[model samples]
Target: EAQIMAEPSGNELASAAAKGDLVQLTNLLQKNVNVNAQNGFGRTALQVMKLGNPEIARRLLMSGANPNLKDSTGFAVIHDVARAGFLDTLQTLLEFHADVNIEDAEGNLPLHLAAQEGHVRVVEFLLRRTPTMGNKTLPRARSPLPYFGVRG
Candidate 1:
């Protein structure tokens, strides 16, 4: 049986993303590093890529990064982009097929996160993107209230 090699720590990937070092990121990816590898903090390069350079994040996605890969807390890259109000970044991830209705461990979706963080643009985008969007499990009072300028 062929032995499966351990994935490299995500530190370099994360660092390259953090600094917008696309060259280094491209090199690491060429070396077969796990694009979805998580760091000590359980954050993958794509997860935190939203925090800094969206272009790098987009490139990573093009390099086959899993947009739906969740962190330790079960939050996906889309969730972070939603919370951060990065509409362009959010669009990039969505274009890469990030599930807009994907829920966290607690069953909160990207719309819920955008609503909670008061990212009106993201909330509106999600609302338009998923017209049938409904959090039936979340009580009406606990539903997406950011659009109404209220917190649940």
Candidate 2:
């Protein structure tokens, strides 16, 4: 009975997504749960989803999850996808129209994060899709991708 009066939140959805539990996630989506609701950590399901799973991203995006929503850390899911070298997941995000150039709290783009992590494939991909050309301005003086052969 108490469960009926509980406030709705995306904790369950985010948990399922973080665990890659497609079944449970689907169940929640079918119930018309708020796809954009923040979890206990103040992050949307798409924000905290398993970064390596494109299928999870696909389902969430199809279910009305906002790919561009930032978490408490001022990071969109693409930032994590890039930093973690999840190429397929990054592709999924792009297909959903996530802003490739979205800046993090530190004012670094996903490209910067991917480059910093030395994710060569992700860097190459971002370089092709990012619209800034070579003139992207950062809050800091230099790129974090010295090892990736990138100049500041």
Candidate 3:
């Protein structure tokens, strides 16, 4: 009885989001599962969601997933989306009112991570939306130059 009444650990939701399984996610939401529940990893469905799928993000956000909730390292879903260069997902998150300026534990904003990772499009998009670019400096600067090398 206690297990039934306990708040969902979000393990299933996290897994569904991680896999980008919109059908399963929809089913879970229909069942009235908590959209923002954290899993054993201390991460929410949005936190572990597949960054490449904007529709999944849209669904989760519409279901009341808190986009600005950070994890142990203070990294939010926006941070991951920016770092991973998922422009669509980022757009969806912003549409849902995710704080583009929220800082991580290291004081790095999503813009910093986007710039450091050499996601030119993401940087440009974030630049247009982010009011402040010079928020906090990274402990060790990661040049976009390295990203180019990897691409090359």
Candidate 4:
């Protein structure tokens, strides 16, 4: 059985991303660290990108990081990108075939994140790319209010 090494913490990777320290991250990856690992709060490097670091996110994605990997809370990279309204990052992820409809533990999809965050442009782009996007269990609403309750 392949031993699953403990995933790296989100905060560590997030900090590296925030500093745009690609070298350190590259070394860590070479050391077999989990690039998509999550932190104590269930936030992965991709999720931390939602806080504003498109360039780093792009680098990580290019380094074979799994865009579909979820944090402990089940939040996918697409969800974080959508929430952050990072159109460029979102597009890049899509180009890599990231799952657009992946949901969190609460069943909130990327559309839900875009809508809830009031990222109209992001939502529009995602909709144009994925017309059939949605969570069947959740009500179909154009706005994300239904998912996050009021734009945030």
Candidate 5:
């Protein structure tokens, strides 16, 4: 027989993060409920930032949430922000030193994801930081077209 683990509350810390309820999140964190905890879908507080709450994401980072944790699909917080074209969230994650070169399971980096969504400013911002990406190959292959498909 397999033992079943009870699911965490639907209104858990991450949910508070999704709602931008920093006060409740702070309280939860104080209780030591794994700041890096993922939801059933493997989404973290940083991934929830793409829901239009840069400030909440920043607060979570300050509270010690790991920015690099990925979802079940290997999508990092930066990837979510890039996909959603949330420049503010992207900048905040970058400032916290989130891994720019990290790829999802599909090998798509944040720049690649940004390009796929046609977020021009995001592409520029990521390109401007390529030298810091520490890998020469990325700067040379920074064109968005390679990652983003041609639109009709």
Candidate 6:
């Protein structure tokens, strides 16, 4: 009856990821549950991984999760990683080819989120990898500010 166990729902997957339960997650994936399945908030396992578990995120990405998939707010997993200052998670996402310049609805990139959160190390890492990222203006800037923070 093992095969008859109920398939993990989207909420289950989200919870497993949130709890960093790699074993359960792997089992669900092996059962062919949708890795990209979103919870009620349209958040995939990858997004939840950004909250705490880079290892889980890594496994999801390796299993072919779409790194660029956006949540309800147009925030991708990279956006979450950047905002939280999860440098290792960000690096793993980058290794999976997560778009460095992906913009949210407001035209804010991961760099913008990192800057807004005052993640200096994240910002420096992003700048080192994508120098042009800093030059881009935020959503409604009347003049080019070269950054997202409030000007002095």
Estimated TM-score per prediction?
0.81, 0.87, 0.83, 0.69, 0.78, 0.83
Best by TM-score: 2
List the lowest-lDDT window of 10 residues for candidate 5.
2-11
Q: List ranges where model 4 is wrong by over 4 Å.
A: 1-12, 30-32, 37-43, 134-152
lDDT per residue as tens, model 5, 27-53: 676666666777666777667643567
Candidate 5 has a TM-score of 0.78
* Better structure of 4 and 5 per TM-score: 5
Q: Over the stretch 1-152, how does candidate 4's per-residue lDDT look in tens digits?
A: 97765655666776676566777666566666667666667666666654355667777877667888787767787887788888988888887779887878887778877877789899889878766555354444544545445542
Q: Report the Cα lDDT for candidate 3.
A: 0.84
lDDT of 2 by residue, 74-108 (tens): 99999999999999999999999999878899887
Residue 40, model 4: Cα distance from true site in angstroms: 5.3
Reference-based lDDT, each prediction: 0.80, 0.85, 0.84, 0.71, 0.75, 0.80
Pick by TM-score: 2 or 4, better one: 2
The TM-score between candidate 2 and the true structure equals 0.87
**Candidate 4 residue pairs in clash (backbone atoms < 3 Å):** none
As for candidate 5, its clashing pairs are none
Among residues 3 or more apart in sequence or in different chains, the pairs in candidate 6 whose N, CA or C atoms overlap within 3 Å are none
C-alpha lDDT of residue 48 in model 1: 70
> What is the C-alpha lDDT profile of model 3 across 9-52, one tens digit per residue?
59999999999999999988887899999988999999998899
Q: How would the candidate models be sorted by TM-score, starting from the highest?
A: 2, 6, 3, 1, 5, 4
The model with the greatest lDDT is 2
After TM-score superposition, what is the CA distance of residue 137 in candidate 5 from its true location, in Å? 3.8
